[model samples]
Target chain A: MRKDDTPNQDRRHALECMLWGGSGLLWTVAGGVPRSSLLGTPEAHAQSAQGGFSFVHISDTHLGFNMAPNPDPTVTLQESLERAKSFRPAMMLHTGDVTHLSRPGEFDRAAQIINATGIETHYAPGEHDVVEDDGKDFFQRFPQGARTGGFYSFDQAGVHFICLNNVTNLQAGKMGMIGAQQLHFLEQDLSARSASTPIVVFAHIPLWVVHEPWGWGTEDSAQLLRLLARFGSVTVLNGHIHQTMQKVEGHVAFHTGMSTAFPQPAPGSRPSAGPIRDLPPGELRKLLGVNRVTRVQNQAALAVVSSPLEG
Target chain B: MQSRRFLLASAPALLAAIPMAQAQQPATVTIDDHDYAPRELRVAPGTKVVWNNKDDTPHNVVSTDNPRAFRSRILDTDEVFEFTFASPGTYSYYCSLHPHMQGRIVVG
Candidate 1:
């Protein structure tokens, strides 16, 4: 693979965030960038009345994630979808990790569970999904193309959504990677897009470095971000971290969706990134949720409201 | 009658020595409830290593090394996979299903 010079840039686009425990959030664009706040608050009802489009971000379902914290994740996934069906988003974007072990039956079970919601689903394979057989079974269920290997794009509600495959072939002691082929495809994909067009990019691992020591960041994401720099209203979504994290760089905003399976510790809060098995009794469900992003007409920002699986 | 008495007398001592004998026989790694017991093992060349899936969840033993020496079928509970090391080296492996559960065997 050829190399590109690392961009001379600072990590000034670090996420600005305030996580709250409740429903109803409002996302608006201030000065052509993204800003988010609670919905019960004033700014929410005012603009929330000006609804544009809505979709669901369901990630890390981990169908075979039978370990504790959540022994049978399929149950929570069912409960989450049952709740989401009420909102009735046009589609659901599953940010990879559809299964814990990428087993055939796991994929089948996840399909049955998610299909019950009656929502069309798009996916990016997580590291767990591609750990064995190099994603043979995963791609079988979600075939983008013969050579696409799970990286592709589509348009919906005036937003260009790109699902890139970055979880396969992770090098030892390294982070997620987007190889040269996918980079070329990305450049070609975006070359046709006007900078003003809103873009939503979804992948399994975080495109930005959340915590490099734990392989939470993508190794070759800088180039991809550089290609996306010109887009005015871009929202990047991911799932590996298993918690909600947000970031912004001028016109770009990054968000990692919470998993339906189990919650890992906050970045750097645990010895290693894996299932969090112990929690104060009902608190486990509180940490699990699905993200709802609502886009309004003139606002480049999209509302990212998290509806936890709990009532 | 004399042989019977001797065998009976040695039973307790032999039972106590069983673990030491097994420990010296080869490297025995247990996959119980999503963890690799001992997490690491050391042994000599030509050592026969065994990984028993003691957990209900299925697990497969696959080496992370390039040109992997051994890869096992998904072993259900109580199933086992065994391999003999002919050369001296460090071999790192994990349950392909649950990658977080890792173990390393050092052969000398």
Candidate 2:
């Protein structure tokens, strides 16, 4: 949908993660296809006591951002996080870019806000998270096992989750790289898992190539995807474009989550990729949001949803 | 007669010295508002080019060349990266964070 649409006529727009709604958007993917419903609906808003399995996915919070697109990113981040909390997600999966420039203050503020929800959060690094001291500061703040290089896997909710660090070593043009060392680690980590288990891989950059010129896609993610192909249910999540872009290829489903900070131009839409800085007053929040994915009982595909902060 | 002869002999040296003098005076590329003002620049050989990041977001200058000509760590706002060119060649560079924010420098 065009960003200029007013409430008088909100048209229906399909699949490409555009500014589709003024209020929160709740997307449900069945058969590997996305279908969104208004969260305002009574049934969609219902809180389940036996919330089987769900997690909040928020990306690009960019806490220090105070610019044309968003004067105060923390404000909207708070609202989006609060919205996720209301769902009572089991854990939070932060795809990456926790801060704007990897500043300590920004990370501190982001950590405080995210932790307030009382949910366990897992993180992958965005290139923004590693700009300072060659990512030493970022690694120090969120250290994993010494051998992992910030890459690790764990089991949760009968699903296997892998978090890879592709942003640490960026190639020219900002393409994400999962180096040989990390790939070997991934191979070993997944070699033992049974094909029957559901697999969710979260990272800062999209594992599938979206647009090569803009570095919207990872250069070597195809190899990683090949390793995951045997799994019966594979879900790949990412955050970098700051918009909701979803795709289903064969058995793998790829989804890029929304940013809580600001919106970015679509791939190849501009000369460069950065925050969309000239939003009209009050329009910024409409494009900023959080993504939620829930696994239903015996369901092979997870239900993915997005809730913009505007409403 | 000796001074006049010296002046005539020094002509070629004087001509050769001109470009060297110009090279001493460096050019500037200011990064502000997510753009490199004067996205392209032209200069003589041995001239130095300095890129200063003036935008709030951090950016870096990286030359797009085989065995890349230059690369800089993230430059916070107001930080600078300078490189001097000794050979005549067109050097293309861009911000690693914002690749589309490209710029070129021609050392002729």
Candidate 3:
């Protein structure tokens, strides 16, 4: 199909561009442009793989969820983690909804499985993650984020990563909110960096409005975007809709990751947003998995590939 | 002065007119399929309203008015939250978790 005819086709073309390089394929940056090749090819052996790093982005594990879509979410989560582990990423960014109900047992089981992967994981809280005791349980388990109220930033291998919280203090008839306090922090955070920095921002809800009626977007993201406009390369990654969506504007690229738990209907396809209740048996896992992001040393844009749990 | 005296004289009768139990006919708002059923409800001033979550997904009730009239903790499936509207006014609320699921109550 010709590109840009429809959103699905656009997504298909984008997915083709961000093809699954983890299947023994080689991805290299030539003259700052990213290109993929077969593993046994001469160019694959000739390119330098150093100075570039990759990370796995997984979201909405929903460990305690047991429903029609998938009676056993934990098994799929495990399988997704296995797929992420295959990438052998420098780190893993769990965009949130780590547990279905944010229960203690759910948190415990999720941690045990994710920790087994042994990759450093950065997290932001989804609304589901903050429901119990206003997120006391989630913060206690993921203490690294607690200090800054689940929003923090760090640098890894020359790439700056910012984790943000947009799910707290949600209001009626409104979408996700990144309150003024957090927005202020983001402004100060960006002011210190030069425009050339390749910034990777991860959050639970999509920073851009995917669908306002379903509460899939963040309310104050315009301000966040203004702060990021100066940056030469900005990648905003999120997962709340339980599907992959991509949009590019100026220097920033926006992408949402797929859930490891269940799939939600595409925006406007269904009346409301929730887990898609019925999928013919064995069809569930095809829509469930993780996304991998890679940044070559000097390339301004990061390459993101969505990997399904099953082949 | 005459209006004040009339209101004072009628206050006791008005208090006695409404049987306490009858004033509190309970109303219900069911959360299912990610939508609030009976999105608009009408009831007496003192009616007690209960919101029950029937979907597996978690939900909450919060008044849309600034200085919210009432709010509920996140409710899991089969869980319920109740509030009594004692004054005459229109109250609008939505699930704070799923903000699009909105409902309204006209109490008079």
Candidate 4:
């Protein structure tokens, strides 16, 4: 769909062209094919919750970041969590990049806000979060996957949830890597699960290659996907790109969420991948938000609704 | 009287220190928009190189060559990290956070 959009050298106009393009897409995967609708229509807003469960996914809070596009990321993150709470999700998944610079105080600030939501939140580390002590700080603060180097899994509502860490030990000039250790863990973990069970895998970087130049994809994600091939329904959620992108292949669906901190240029829309500063006043929040995923009981379908902090 | 004579004698040494300090001033590489300015820098052995992050995002410098010569802590905007290239060799480095932002230092 974006192929029709022309690339503009003007950064602001380019951002406008790309940022507004994907904002209101309501994504759903039924029968292993993805579909979308404009948000706010009855078909999009309406949801059936009878005998079903839902969860929230938010990413890239970047708590300590203080700059244009957003001077106080903490405020936006708090707002996102409050919005997430309203969904009454059984749990929340943070795809990674909880802090901007991986400082202790930044983690403290992020914790205070996320915990305030009172929802169990699972985390995967982004490259930014593991900059300190090789992710010892991140693991110590969020110990759900600490023993296994920040990747773990659990069963919730008959859906198997696997949180994988792909940011550590990243090779130069390459995308995020899950490495051999985590792949072995994933293989072992999935082997015992029934193939009929729905699987939701969440991580910091997109399991599929979004763009090679910016390192938006995961290096060993193909191997990871192969392990998941036997599953009847698989939905992959990620957060590193800081924008909304979704695709479906076979029985697998991939979606990347927006950041609560700031917006980044769409793939190949800018010279380099970083925060998109100089956005018009009040436009930042529209491009920054969270994802709310709903799973129907005994159904292979998952409805993913994205809500902006504003608009 | 002895203190005054000592001060006068030390004045020449202090005067000589200024130029020596100036000679030791490090070469700079500005990190802006996720790219290092002067992506390839040439410096004499024993010269110091400093990386100044001017972009809003945080970045770090890590040697990518075999044996990994130098690494720096994450540098936020306006923060600086320095490494003295005391050996003559081709040093390749990149921002660990954004690996695409690569650079090289040729010391001879």
* Highest-scoring model, lDDT: 4
**What lDDT score goes with residue A156 in model 2?**
88
State the DockQ of every prediction.
Answer: 0.13, 0.19, 0.48, 0.53
Q: What value does the lDDT take at residue B13 in candidate 1? A: 72
Model 3 per-residue lDDT at B47: 73
Q: What is the lDDT of residue A91 in candidate 3?
A: 90
- Runs of candidate 4 exceeding 4 Å displacement: A1-24, B1-23
RMSD each, Å = 8.6, 8.3, 6.9, 8.8
Ranking, TM-score, top scorer first:
4, 3, 2, 1
Interface RMSD of 2: 3.3
- Candidate 3 per-residue lDDT over residues A102-215, each given as its tens digit: 889999999999999998998899888987577999999998789777899999876788999998878777898889888888888888887767788999989999999888
Candidate 4 per-residue lDDT, tens place, B11-108, comes to 66664554323324589999998899999999866567899999888999999977789889999999999887766789999888887788999987
Model 4 C-alpha lDDT per residue in residues A97-159, reported as the tens digit of each score: 999999999988889888887899999898899976888778889999888888999998777
Tens digits of per-residue lDDT for model 1 on A1-311? 10112211232321121122126444443433445666578655655455556678889998876667888888889878876776667788899889866779999998888877779998888877777777888888878632678799999877789999887766545678899999999999999988767788999889999987666888898899899987766888898888888777766778888889889889778665656777889988888888876666643234556677763
Better of 2 and 4 by DockQ: 4
Which candidate order results from sorting by lDDT in descending order? 4, 3, 2, 1
lDDT of 2: 0.74
Residue pairs with backbone atoms closer than 3 Å in model 1 (clashes): A15-A247
Residue runs of model 2 more than 4 Å from their true location after superposition: A1-23, A40-50, B1-19, B32-46, B54-57, B63-71, B76-79, B84-94, B99-108
Candidate 2 reaches a DockQ of 0.19
Give all candidates' CA lDDT scores.
Answer: 0.73, 0.74, 0.77, 0.80
Better candidate by lDDT, 3 or 4: 4
DockQ-based CAPRI category assigned to the predicted complex of candidate 1: incorrect
